[model samples]
Target: MAECVACKQSSMAQYTIHNVRFFDFNPKAIHCMSYDDATSRLALSRTNGDIEIWNCWSRPFMQLFLPGDNDSSVEAMVWCQGRLFSAGLHGFLLEHNLASREVTLRTPITGGPTWCLALSKDKKKLAAGTERGYVCIFDVVDSGVMYDRALEKQEGRILHIAWHISGDYIVTGSVNCVRVWSLKEGRVARCGLGAADRKDEVIVWCVGILDDMTLVSGDSSGRVCFWNAELGTVTHSVHTHKADILALTVCPDQKSVYVAGVDPTIVQVSRVETGTKKGKVEMWVKGIQRSIHTHDVRALVVTATDRVYSGGVDTILTLSYFPPRTVCKFPALPPLGSISVAREAESLLLQYSDHVELWRLGASSKKGGKSGTFLPVTKDRVKLLELQGKDDEVIQWCAVSPKARWIAYLVQGSLRIYHFTPPASGKQPRVQRVKEVSQEIKKSHQMLWLSEGKLVSAAVTGAIQVINVSGSKAELEKELTLSPGHSVLQMTCDLEGKMLAVVDSKNIITIFDIEKETISVLPGHSSPCTAVGIHPLTKEVVAVYADMSIKEYDPSKQCYTAFCRQHLNEPSSELAKKHSVILRVSFDPDRPDLILLHNESAFVVVQKDKMAADVSQEKAPKVKKVTSGSSPGKGAKAGIGAKFSVIRRPNQVLLFSQMKGEAVVSVELNPLQVMDRLPSPLKVKKYGGT
Candidate 1:
């Protein structure tokens, strides 16, 4: 309900778009990360103690999450023998259970406030560096991590630690110097970093060990130094960054080293063999550098296959491939939006990590401004309800009923429902928990509310649960179990919740009739279905495939609509499929022939009108026409192919919801606004520039 930009679109009801630009969903910064090559899984810990398990096989999909405590924080994380472990300033080692999405074991370290965590090459021991300047070692046992002993104490805090592959020595980076400890003899071999002067102490943030026993360290002085572990002398050093280097990683081939930090650039150092006066000498030199981030990069990892994964204070996960020069930026946001809107009541539900809030949509200026102008606000948004979660579990999904009479949210494996009564004039609203939910409903992974007071949910096994909720009672109505092997990839429902469309992993579309308790399959397609929607008026199910082709199904007729057949067979429609992956499909109630499909980047409004079924202009307002041809050689003409218009906006849309009065609201967050809230990035002096 923040002050939004109001845009008037030419369509059947002259719809207005509430381009909301005040959605505040700031993600936490990444502190550290670890990768397991065996399973291709990544364990990333945020500034908060929360840990996220990401599947890195084909893509970075966040599979499981372990919520953190209020007073806790994670400083470092490491993966050990397929087991995920984290240590933080809380001074305890944590073992996470992926199945339960919780911490299974917590063992305190011998020293105070662990600052760094490193796994040994043998995968049998873990070393924890502490703020008290001690390196504590632990044995990885079947029971859990058990404290073994502590290394010799140093003067400064142990900011970083790295274990050599030989297991005979370990390297530690501290305030003013880097030290190499001989584990076999239990003593320090190297005691200095060759600092020109000790007046201004340099803070070492990260260190790594290469296969050739070269100690790599990045410090506050913007230097990447390679040290000879045995001689404790610097071999080569380079000023690769403008600020402190917070992260460093060595490739498995021992040929490339990546260093990044406050400067937000990843500088690659490659091993080069130079023919010197004496003989061929192996040397390290700075190579290609990519400015991939906008803020400090705190974590970097190079997998066995040479894939680079990096994250930092900007809350962005970047995947990089060197030779191909391929870099993809993945936002840290979850799949679904944390915000939901109640169309009828005009109320918004905001979901946070530990709580949920209900806010009233504000009023806009009667005289709307231009498309991009910030319309004047008539009323400020007001807060109505704040419901704290029962426990410290991340709220996966939350929704408010169409009329704002109910609210449902999923936390962990539990689905909680509450009766939300809108506030009357001069009176406060009320929220009461609707208890005794069916066990099947509690296990649901997603939830939706129909206008007629019915709740639809999908379980982990792709099963459907329909529950009748009213006042303070929730009764199980029906449960439809899907086939054992089919996994649901996308799900959607109509206004009345009668038609539920589910797309499986195999690109099959299944429509369920909630009232009749029946199911039907639509004609299959070659490309996979990316999104689906149920028409509110005509009750036709719409499916959009990976190739950007679309289809309309008559659920009642159990066949494809004639209009859909034409769209699929037309060769001119190839332009529709070449955009980004469409994630959501929104229908226009007034113009049933038009559908709005959107990804995170842009909106696509596809007008699928049959040549014979075209409505007269007197009956409905004419839609804005697109004159551009779909393809290069195709001529622009009406009633020839599927005509679609693409609208690219400036902000990223977090939520898009349809209302009753032919109006739609798109909650967007500005990129500049997001950066304004982040910690100030390093400002480097340019050559003759402001």
Candidate 2:
């Protein structure tokens, strides 16, 4: 054992060194020991299932009795009045009375040996830790035992215990963790000892309550660390034990402490004389190994009579009267405010900062007080990926390829491909470098990836570039220039990437056979074709006209048909029916049957069959409502009476129409939301609408 330089109490040695001796009356292993502050009586558990009670004030007041002959070994001991509670392996709990030496047994607990045991300060409840790595609380009654609760947090066994000063809560060390639990709430208050690093692991074993909201724990490495509960801080740490620390106890005056372990011969007395000053403890060691027992010492207890009681493998009770000394050094670390625990492969992860962190949980835990170690969570740990574009060359739209491995980005005047790593790889994300080879075309407003690694790029200059990307290097295999006055604007591709459909400067859609490298422009609409999409599985091209009309191009019939139209037309026959035009058209990637059409004022959901029915049913309402005449009565007018009339316009139903003109004039109408003013024809038509 070693002395801590902080929070030490100064105590002088009262007993002489010559007095250290042991009386070997019994020969058995000691499992657990305890002291009753109220009665000044100390209880000791022996390997043969016997408990030895000693009156610390008396020189030779020691009595031994058998509790039970259970097969399991005793793990912990708690005392109340003349009764003793013992937790043993295989969930064995035996109660024995010192007065009559009568043994009474309670219900079986969980599984394996009880790793930790604690009795409330008032002796109203008893908590037992099981090898199953969970905590069970039992209420202590006069006649028998009653079930209380179980704590479910730590993934391993609990090994240490320390009750809060208020007797309202308790903390236990288990599986490299220190957990605080509230008796009133019946839940975990906090868990500590977290690590962020992926490597070094630690566990907490024995814990001692230094004050109301402060405690200290000794881990497997024989390190004693202090923590404050209110403020999360590790004030100090001292390596005090050469072997695992078995137990910890606070000094009577609440200033000093006593620790015992493998070095049985020497009992280290740590006294805090100076307040948080370095080298404050006046260190002294007493040869109490022989006095504790004839065998290895396992447990120790401090009695109210100012005497120390020890139990060991020799099954003997050792007592000594020792005086205290004052020693002082640095203060202990503050208690941890919060803790986050996570489980990783074979290791437990712990986080102790304001934010949660990730770590691997280690295997071993000392006496149970180890809060596993963890690292901090920082922004640098997480990376972000972003793609930027030029001022006017904004990314108008984006679509992932059929395989979901490649993404096609449509810019103001060009197309780009980005290849991404699949999720199965479990590696950092990366994007492919797009090879720009569209020099033949001034600029592509849109592009689509077709089958056989072919891409069709459309420019506003009535030119299209068909490039093949099957090879590592991109090659312009074909170029298709549209007729004069025909420039492409929006485009789409089918699911198999076999066919490409694009809307040109005029309200005409051009369907191209990617494999055959052929393009055909189908003239059908009077206004510009604002958007284009295709049925991925069916290879059907869907075109949206500036008049809000959807037309499908039938490849076998080689004819245009009214697919669908929005009922948003004004009364003026010259004005187009579609308000502000359909700016975007897309087919549901997941549901091939659904099509989405969005414009400035409204959005439309179109299905193949429903769209056909909507178009076929388009017809003007016949009746028109109008005020024929209004006459003034006597209450309305005492003078000359007058008649008034109001005219109501008939609602015009939008139906299928043909775009038969010399040149299919198409214009990319600006979305109404951003348009400064409506066209004179459109404004006049809107005023004439019902």
Candidate 3:
């Protein structure tokens, strides 16, 4: 923990990196992320016109696909009722329905691109800021637009907006100024143009409304400003990030504010009572530190449960915990090109453009490091293989078998499978293409191993083909065809390998039962289906659609139920709709109920019973809830109906729990600690001398 000189009078809160999640899609940049307090879901918007939603506790649940040819990057998104209202580069507010999986409505608004958005506390009003310096306010009811008004213009694009908790005012950040708008008057109430001493025009990148009504704004100048929301004057300002501050969030307690941005640092600003003035409080930088993200931090949301979630340019999602002050990292996915993870071999195979590289994870060292130091030592990394392709052709997708003995990749609309030979005594292993098979399938998009000898593939021609590889020959076994215009997007097989779930371009989930040799089409989505997964325990099919909706289809019942509807209250319906389409769903190997959903931006972990309540009622063991205060904003509602609690541990800490007079102990070892214990030549160098 780094101490802030200005916060000497205040006590700092310890924060650690809890978890990091990496995205599969290579986004140019992550624009923003919004958290729904009602459903505990997080929505992420990217530069590629993609919006994704994740169950706050689980992986990605859905993604929203643009409805028309005018696909523009989403700039700002807000949730209302059961729909997501997004304004972006297309200059139109798109209303996406989570239940129906469709763009229910689209309305043209002022400005070429809407940059920021905020929803009122009561969920009735919405405010959007645009590239043309206009602030648009709208009345939302029953997931439909009632009316909209564009306020008087500012000078530059509106980059950030936050509605006051009271729902009477909205604070907006734009080029060179921060302004407060009155909801009742429908006009600007107050405006602060930053420090008069500053000569350069500062672009405000993020804003947050605190509990005490003070407005916090982070700008490109790397300064965080605190203003009196009503008076519209700068109360205090502090230099925070080294680069642009892109993300900001107010803690539910209202006592602290979290900020992150272009720099890798995350700063926590807290309000402390002034010693000289008994009743007055001042903002202080209580904690400042860096996380594992290697790039610009773009989006942040402090959930109602008090956990801080951050998404960054590195394509990773990091969770920061408070009491333990620990950080955890989750990587979204392998880069967009071609990549495959061999869990059993502990290796990663990646293809960038025309070059392929294989990386192996080294075994953990038995050594230990100094008690309180974190050093960046290169872990055992070995580049085992490199394959170069023709300059014009690139690997589009790739997959490795469970044991990593067989490798398959797609290039130039052709699928190729190769046998990987392990290195023998004093000899290096090599890869050899089996045999050239006739191209019976046209335009292959994705391929995966169904078994050690079987491969499943989806193509643009709306066909799912299963191929059998015996020794050196490849033979097509079966081909399943969808409707003429529907193309396969993603596919996954059940744990038993008897069933396969396929999501197609037409937003339908098709389940192929191997035993019956029959296909059952589950139709409910309104947009294209991105991903599908079969529950390991119950074998129910959970499908994520482009309109940001997640549904579970029970083949036995022949019925579909909204996955997240029962877990969240009515207010969260709007949040459920604001998520992007879910690109993938994965079940934990050890826990069948634990599912991970991911898209381009972030991934979340959710339990089956909590999300798919219609499927089962076997509840997870409940833990004691902890609270900071009796007030609702405090810890009163934190994780109110949550199924899981976050636990953080230090590198050397041991936790002991007592249940019914029985003690259970768990020990955790940090990866760095293991590396430090190793007698490696790299550890002999001085700390700062290169």
Give the TM-scores of the predictions, in the order they appear: 0.77, 0.39, 0.53
lDDT of 1 by residue, 1-690 (tens): 365444433333234566565556877888888999998888888886667776665435554556666766888888877788888878899887554345679998877799998889999989989988888889999889888888888887899999999877788999878898888777687776646766887998888887777889999989999888778788898999988999999999989899999999999999899998999998888999888898999999999999889999998778888787878776665445267778877778888877888887776656544443455667778788988985656676788888778888987657788998767997878889998776546475567786546887766656777889877778888887666766555567887767888776455888988778789898888666667899899989888665666788898899988787754454224344333456678787778877777766555666665333443332323334343221110222221232555555556656666766756777776666668889888888789999
Which one is best on lDDT?
Answer: 1
| TM-score preference between candidates 2 and 3, better one | 3
After superposition, which runs of candidate 3 have C-alpha atoms over 4 Å from their true positions? 1-28, 58-71, 97-104, 277-283, 334-498, 501-690
Clashes of 1: 1
lDDT of 3 by residue, 231-350 (tens): 788888888777888888888888888888777678887777675556665656656565656667888888877888887666556777767766766544332224555545655566
Q: For every model in order, what is the number of clashing pairs?
A: 1, 57, 53
Which pairs clash in model 1?
548-577
Model 2: per-residue Cα lDDT over 439-542, one tens digit each: 56445445555643566666545567777664244667777766676655446666566677765434467787777876666656554455677765556667
**Where does the lowest 10-residue lDDT sum fall in candidate 3?**
1-10
lDDT of 3 at 531: 64
TM-score of model 2 vs. true structure: 0.39
Alpha carbon lDDT of each predicted model: 0.75, 0.48, 0.61
lDDT for model 2: 0.48
Q: Give the higher-lDDT candidate: 2 or 3.
A: 3
